[model samples]
Target: MALITKTDLYFTDYSWSAIEPDDPRVTGEPDSTLLNRKEGYEILYFINKLSDIWSLKNKSSATKIERMIRFEVPSNIHSQLTIRIWIHDNWNESRY
Candidate 1:
């Protein structure tokens, strides 16, 4: 596999201009107002399995990162729920 950079994980704000330019909500919209206008996102549970994948014998070859996320949303909501995971990458840092 290839290296994972910061830009690969970056998510931009939602824009209504592309979908509906004539909509009143899209006119002179603030940065916050343009983001996630319809969907609701919540993180119910997040787990990082670092120790399970880390091995002393294969430390040099163990470069992959594994993540598991679980979300439980109620059926009453009309719109779909969204979830995002933010990761900070520090090349100089030794700690994983």
Candidate 2:
């Protein structure tokens, strides 16, 4: 079985994040090969939406969506992660 050392999560609202590089499940680099696929290591994740509301409805002008992500891992170790959120059309790269 191939190991899954990296994980990419995406949301319907166009938000995304990745967990990689120093992920606790990754014991070491995989052997150099055509696919560079790792073995033996695996990571499992349980995704749940903390908030009850998935979409905004009759929200006040003062209210806003926070662009942030927080999660806990079994290893209790810190790893570098990146998250991308779609703020608007102008901010999109394809426009360039």
Candidate 3:
């Protein structure tokens, strides 16, 4: 007899919140600053997970990232979504 294993992939729906200028999270902050730092942090965390699942490196190419996104997200969501890649000077060293 031999042991066997199975794996499956699942996609979850995501929603973005509307940010107001008067919101305490961004109130009095410069326009150049992050509008939604929490959201940005979550996105970065998700991207890292994708990279791990796809055996990708931290500096993986944009095309590779796109492919991973396409593979993990449903077609309908991907089609209607817009993705932005932010590359900070210290991205590799930053915790978030």
What is the Å distance of residue 19 in model 2 from its true position?
1.7
List model 2 lDDT by residue over 1-96, tens digit each: 211112322222332235464654333422121111112122212111111113223222001212122221212322212111221221223222
Rank by TM-score, descending? 3, 1, 2
**Which segments of candidate 3 are over 4 A away from where they belong?**
1-38, 62-96
Give the whole-model CA lDDT for all candidates, comma-separated: 0.22, 0.22, 0.33
Better of 1 and 2 by TM-score: 1
Question: How many pairs collide in each candidate, listed in order?
Answer: 0, 0, 0
Comparing 2 and 3 on TM-score, the stronger one: 3
lDDT of 3 by residue, 1-96 (tens): 101111111222333456564554333312233322224323333444334434554443323343344443333332111222332222344332
Quote the positional error of residue 44 for candidate 3 in Å.
0.5
TM-scores of all models? Answer: 0.16, 0.14, 0.27
